[model samples]
Target: MRSPASLVLLALPFTLAVPAPAAGNLGSATTQNGLTAGGCKAMTVIFARGTTEQGNVGSLSGPPWFAAMSKAVGAQNLAVQGVDYPADIPGFLAGGDKKGSAKMAQLVMQAMTACPDTAVVMGGYSQGAQLVHNAAAMLPADMAAKVSSAVLFGDPMNGKPVAGVPAGKTKVICHQGDLICAGTSTILMPHLTYSQNAGEAAQFAATAAGM
Candidate 1:
């Protein structure tokens, strides 16, 4: 088993964009290095995953996933960060481990605060999806409003709908073939099930464009 910090560090290479100072002193947005270009406003998108299992982001080559999605959507700039936590963190946190959740929530809030002008998008796979939802729920109403869209993949709402997420701006994508879909949680299923290797990337781009 990997230590929480180790897992986070390992996952960092996959999602972190270069850290850039938000324009006009809006704090620094965490982004992959060398991925930013001038004359483009940066947007922060948080990528969360399930069961503490890292996603394909670490394995992909070329630009970072968030940058690619941002480019696809034509954003001037983009930043992506992964929400790292132990697989059992949620369970322990729910069982009164407020410290852990609160700490994680604070980290997320800092990321959001750093990019005040940038639109925010939250995406998660499996367990990571739930973390994003929970983090979004914890945001102050004003901060939550900054979020342009939220995408939950492979995980249902699980009876905990993220408050303040505008219905029109939220989307859910799930794999029908994945057994995780059989749960009774509340999430809008994707139009097509089955695996789409690049589908997640495409959907993120399309959604960002719509925002």
Candidate 2:
């Protein structure tokens, strides 16, 4: 059997396509390396893609959010890094991928340590949102508090706090019909439409991150 990413290639029912690199900010590359490239910027966005999604940042959410954030914070001032993980359904069923969540947390601290002046934002979609919650719990309060903000779309853990992150600094955008936001595994139309909320989430992140 093939993975969901591959399955998406065979079927178009899910509409997994994201917004084409969010207006060329990412070009055609599906992966990102701003955090580990020995480069620092005004802000760092560590985003995790949804389960069964393509690349590290799924086209359905992360890219759109990145586009909005780029406009809000200025592309030159922003850096994006997508979390690497299996993004398989099994991981989502397991309450997010363990290794992925750990990596996200590490990236957060790494961003802070590497760029003391740069703002750090944790973000994700679908199971990726679950990873955001898990990653927040893995960090110490002091370190977590240092994180500038968090933005989650089509969240599986909606209405739940993002551990040590201040409620005011975190944004969770869930559509009313999105079953995943309601804490269920069922994927609904609302969940697939999170890209529409990208601007709103990005604006909130910009304010929270002091952009």
Candidate 3:
């Protein structure tokens, strides 16, 4: 059998012919660089991807920001885990296909359990940004308090009232014209890009994680 990523390609052509499913699952798929061999605990950065994006929580190309942030995080000797979830259009509106928000809470709990002293810095883009907020809100107070920082870009719920990390620890970055967070859907261009702010975001996260 082919890999799940490859299988997506086989199903792509038919996706247009037939309706697509809600992309994938609500599992905690983490991609990191510097974890010690026997799961030694280290400072951690958790990233969540936007709609339709695949692989790790962050992409390596197109928008270089994610990759840039990954590089910076590695420089800090911290591990990065890109979270996985159903980020499809429908799934996002329906609050994820298998309780994506709930799974993220569990993911956080598991991470803390596995690496007790690990400092967690998290972020997400677009729909993934919304996921970050939802996940943060769902976590138990003690667990949520352990999170060092949360950075969100183009979150649909940016300006709205939502549960999330503490105000001081949370940073919401919305471009002037990005309507998703700004509530202006008429313009579709600005919402598609955010590479310029990736480095600054990474730096902030690194500092918050004490790296």
In terms of TM-score, the best-performing candidate is 2
Across residues 1-211, which tens digit of lDDT does each residue of candidate 1 receive?
Answer: 2134533444344334433333221112222322122222455565543443333112121123454465465544555554545534344224212333344456546666654566566665555556666677777887777677776655534335566877666766656554344453222224112134344654654575364
Full ranking by TM-score:
2, 3, 1
Query: lDDT value for candidate 1?
Result: 0.47
Per-model CA lDDT versus the true structure: 0.47, 0.83, 0.59
RMSD of 3: 8.4
lDDT per residue for candidate 3 within 10-101, as digits (tens), equals: 32343234222232221222233323223534566566666566554534111344445556666345555556576665554543334666
Report each candidate's C-alpha RMSD, comma-separated, in the order given: 9.1, 3.9, 8.4
CA deviation > 4 Å runs, candidate 1: 1-41, 55-70, 74-76, 89-104, 158-160, 184-211
The residue-by-residue lDDT of candidate 2 on 51-87, one tens digit each, is: 8777778788877788888888898988899899998
Clashing pairs in 2: 18-59
lDDT of 2 at 102: 100
Judge candidate 1 at residue 45 and give its lDDT.
60
Per lDDT, the best of the predicted structures is 2
After superposition, which runs of candidate 3 have C-alpha atoms over 4 Å from their true positions? 1-41, 58-66, 70-76, 95-98, 160-164, 184-187
